[model samples]
Target: MLKGLVIVCANGCFSSMTEANSKVKALLAGRKARQCCELLVLESALGKGGAPWDFQRGSDFSNVDPFAFIVLA
Candidate 1:
């Protein structure tokens, strides 16, 4: 891993151990409430207002949702 490859954010990242731990707990506690919402967000089937997997069919995000892709170390 690289030194400057880590990023800290409100949703929780490697910036703080406490916040990062909390984020993990949330995920493990079946707090995946955003699963459906996230899938729909990436769906360009209806211009980002549809429902499905990510927009990898040569399309752009219709409604850009502030998303953060995190990796735990």
Candidate 2:
């Protein structure tokens, strides 16, 4: 099966690690992105809840399309 993978910027900078973390939180918080291909916040998501799901970063997440995964960080 093909799983969806997204790259979230959570380093605070645009497309950074901070942004990635935020996007993930937004999604989990029920804040859907209004923009198409909106940048994801990966850090915030990881902050809110420990990864009970099978989500991986820098390995399975890298090299994949950002929109492909539903990250909540």
Candidate 3:
């Protein structure tokens, strides 16, 4: 299932992480050299204005990093 999804995304049905990362890297590289860093926002398919995941709350989140948020709206 994961392989199928990745293949679809790679075929342009959706944007994959590799594409997003490259785009972000290029954008940041062009910014002012003096700046330490900058932020680049990308829409997520899982939690960005979408249904919640199977394990999105309470103890389920305990096994996951706080920064690794699902895109549930």
Count of clashing residue pairs in every prediction: 0, 38, 3
lDDT of 3 by residue, 16-59 (tens): 55565565566457435316544443333333333344555535
Estimate the lDDT of model 3: 0.39
Minimum summed lDDT over a 10-residue window in model 1 is located at 36-45
Which candidate has the top score in TM-score? 3
> Where does model 3 exceed 4 Å of error?
1-14, 31-35, 38-73
Candidate lDDT scores, in order, read 0.38, 0.42, 0.39
lDDT of candidate 1 over 6-33, digit per residue (tens)? 2234332245555565655454455444
lDDT of 2 at 30: 43
